[model samples]
Target: MANAVPVADFLVLPPRLDRTAEMLAESARRRGMAVEHLSSPVVPARLQHSAGGHLYGGPTFAAAVAPDLDLVPLEPADDWLPQLPYEYTHRDIALTTLGEARWSRTPMFVKPPRDKTLPAGVYVDGSRLPGDERYPADTPVLVSEIVTFLVEYRLFVLDGMVHAASRYAVNGRLDPAPLDACAHRAAVLDFAAGLLDACADSLPSAVVVDVGLASNADRGDEHWAVVEANMAWFSTSYAANPDQVLDVVLRAAGPRHRLTLRDQAFTRPPTPFPGTGRSGSSPMS
Candidate 1:
């Protein structure tokens, strides 16, 4: 009930029906929620309407819309640095090259810093790690310290509030094992909320905080670390519980706002700097 916001869908698929915002919105409607669809004429030609708040969409969406809507991104804009080799963030940090992470905790799980786009992987310092089915080295890969965990958990925060959470285990040991769900929940919420608050002004409408079991000094205790930050849009919802995620998005993605190209919305203006627009400036956001 705290996330009582109204939302509309901005379809990025062209009049061609190439995307799923309509279908997804319909599903929400059946659950007694309200969603609106915008007409192209009112929006800027270069602009698009996307669900999950474009947190995972192409940088173009952010570039075009940021100037019009006061949206801040939890992650970096696309085209910053290569994704962090692992699934963690220092918040609002930028990586200009792979060399920044030259010294890293080996056996890391490299993942991309930005979400929604492709050509990313979780790699080790130089080993041929598995999970390549989802991440091939063909594209730029994120090299991170490999973290094996009792389980991986995700927390979805909406408007500075803790809304929903889910935990996953490649192994089912934690299903009923003696693990403290509330503590992990608390850790994820505390860290993510602080990070979000740090960049609260630019926080997107919806985003997911992924928490991993990092090393702890408790000897045999399972340690938790913030592995990867992801957008709520295309996250597999595997480790995440379905109903809870859906509910949070439905509530957070609200009150459709139409901003004209001429309107000034986003406060943090990007510097055109002559040649930056030709390609995405940085890939990390």
Candidate 2:
């Protein structure tokens, strides 16, 4: 048989590749692309030109590999998509950092703006927040009104279009099911389109925008609401079409990416993979 030509390439961490990463590598190989599993968690300089791009675990990994590729590294998820409604006047949703948190009597969903150092959960009142030992007192956080997600979907967006999406959660649980491309999927996509249009200029060229069905008695019915944004490099693919997700992954961290002024401030060391007892770091914080 004639030697196959490569269509794409991958740079993955060895020993433990997440299901999504594994799927991407397998899919790429199936298509005659090359995948290199590295033990050092570093993207070698040689691959910078030969390989399409690298897929990192998180911002830290991306930062580590960036020096090898001589490319601008990625910013934290929070910085990439800062408190949307608060940063952008067009968004009605309320979002603020824990330090500046002013909500009393009302519960809010709080989570670390970038990494999983802090667990994401609903705080009945700001007073109940765990002590600030984990992160600095001034650490940025996402504090938003608790909204119910009847069904949540993760969309892989690229340049104003959603390449692929998957329903990953239902009623705040880990329920992954392929959404029919009919009414249900249409509803989710429609909601996403409206959101993207509303905040067209605010979002990055490539990122993951999560949306969900929420019921507002005052509004009288269930409608779609923003569930916050995640960095495309780190967000789980869930059940999203693997091939489509891989394509987004490639473009999201492709060579065209430029370093932001904030990337220089990203000096924190790499975080360990989740559930790997090898590392003392916490996962899904």
Q: Lowest lDDT 10-mer window, candidate 1?
A: 259-268
- Deviation from native of the Cα of residue 67 in model 2, angstroms: 1.6
Give all candidates' CA lDDT scores: 0.42, 0.61
What are the per-residue Cα lDDT tens digits for candidate 1 across 116-211? 343344445543343344444343435533335555666666655556666655332444211234446566566556655654434344556666
Residue 229, candidate 2: C-alpha displacement in angstroms: 0.8
Minimum summed lDDT over a 10-residue window in model 2 is located at 276-285
In the range 28-115, model 2's lDDT, one tens digit per residue, is 7777767777766554545643334556466545655544443332333455334454322122333366656534557767877656
Q: Where does candidate 2 stray beyond 4 Å?
A: 1-9, 43-51, 72-95, 102-106, 181-183, 217-220, 256-285
Instruction: List ranges where model 1 is wrong by over 4 Å.
Output: 1-27, 31-108, 116-143, 170-205, 216-221, 239-285
TM-scores of all candidate predictions against the true structure:
0.48, 0.75
